[model samples]
Target: MKNTILRFNDAVYRLCIAVAGLSMLTMALIIPWGIFARYVLGSGSSWPEPVAILLMVVFTFFGAAASYRAGAHMAVNMATDRMPPALRQGAAILVQILMAVVCLFMAVKGWKLCANTWNQFLGEMPGLRVGVSYLPIPVGGVLTLLFVLEKLFLGDQSHRRVVRFDLVEESEGAA
Candidate 1:
């Protein structure tokens, strides 16, 4: 059962990373084209800007979930690191609980926002629903919530430090 849950979590983590990466890649391609169209071609494209904004929203939220799962989210570990073992464990638990609360708040509020805007359309892209753009907020929140639970209960292997053999080999060759 634990293994199954861990595998599911891993799958979600990979999905978040892939989606974020693709969104960023799409934005990278779109922005340059937008600039070229506006400056060189002398006609600005309406689609690129809105599309880029949407992609950015997706990238940021999903990337955040992936980062949190990997324990890459910004955190000051100075105080916790110095604490005694028992205290450290307690502190960690407290932090996780706090994080869970925050994630819950985000999920609830984001869903409400998404639902409220369901009937509204984007100003720039009339065909697109405004609620669709707000989707990442709740999705990211839920992902983060699951990751936090996994860390709290199952232990988080994602944050473990790892040495890259390829990087080590390259460095040795450089010397």
Candidate 2:
């Protein structure tokens, strides 16, 4: 059971990385095109700026979830690291609990925000709904929540073979 859950989470982590990476790559490509179009072509494209902004939102949210799972997210451990072992453990658990609450808030409130604006459409991208653009909030919230639970129960899979590709390659080379 534990192995199965870990495997599933490994897949989820990969998916988040892919989504975030793709969004960033697309934004990178499109922004340059937008600049070129405006300066060289003497006309600006309407879709690029709005699309880039939306992609940025996607990149931020999804990338954050992946970073959290990989233990790459920013964390202020100055105070916690100074504590005794037992106190440190308690603080870690408390931090996870607080993270869960924040995730829940993001998921619930983000979903409501999406629903409330579902009918509205973007002026820049008329066919796309405003709510659709905000989808990363709730989706990222749920993904982060999953990682939080995995850490709480499975005890930090950051060192796992799936999460640590560099370590895996080193081990394989040694073998």
Candidate 3:
């Protein structure tokens, strides 16, 4: 059962990475086209700038969730690292609890924001709803929350084989 949950988280982590990467890639493609269209083609495209901005939001939120799971998120641990083992453990629990609270706030408030904005459409991209652009916030919050729960209950899965394929390769090479 623990293995199943870890596998599920691994899949989620991959998905988050994929979404963030695609968003970044698409944004990279878009901004250049917008610049080219304005300077070379003598006409600016209306959709590209707004679309790129939306993509940036998507990239940031999804990438953050994946970063959290991978233990790559920015954390100032110098103070905690200096503590005794028992104090360090307590501090770690406190940090996780704080993380969980922040995640819940993001999920709840983000959903409310989405719902409130659902009726509005972007002027630059008429077909796209404003709410749709904000979807990543709640989604990312939920994903990060899941990772937090996994850590609290199952312990850190960052060392698991599925999460760290590079470690597996290194072990195989040594063997």
Best by lDDT: 2
TM-score to native of every candidate shown: 0.89, 0.92, 0.91
Angstrom error at residue 87, model 2: 0.6
Residue lDDT tens for model 2, 32-145 = 999999999999999999999999999999999999999999999999999999999999999999999999999999999999999999999999999999999999999999
Question: lDDT tens digits, residues 122-141, model 1?
Answer: 99999999999999999999
Candidate achieving higher lDDT, 1 or 2:
2
**Predictions in order: lDDT:** 0.90, 0.94, 0.90
Ranking by TM-score: 2, 3, 1
Worst 10 residues of 3 by lDDT: 160-169
> lDDT, candidate 2, residue 47?
97
Per-residue lDDT tens digits for candidate 3, residues 1-175, read: 8866886888899999999999999999999999999999999999899999999999999999999988889999899989999999999999999999999999999999999999999888889998998888898899999999998888987766565656546877999
What candidate 3 gets wrong by more than 4 Å, as runs, is: 163-175
**Any runs in candidate 2 off by more than 4 Å, and if so which?**
163-175
Cα displacement (Å) at residue 15, model 3: 0.4
lDDT of 2 at 60: 93
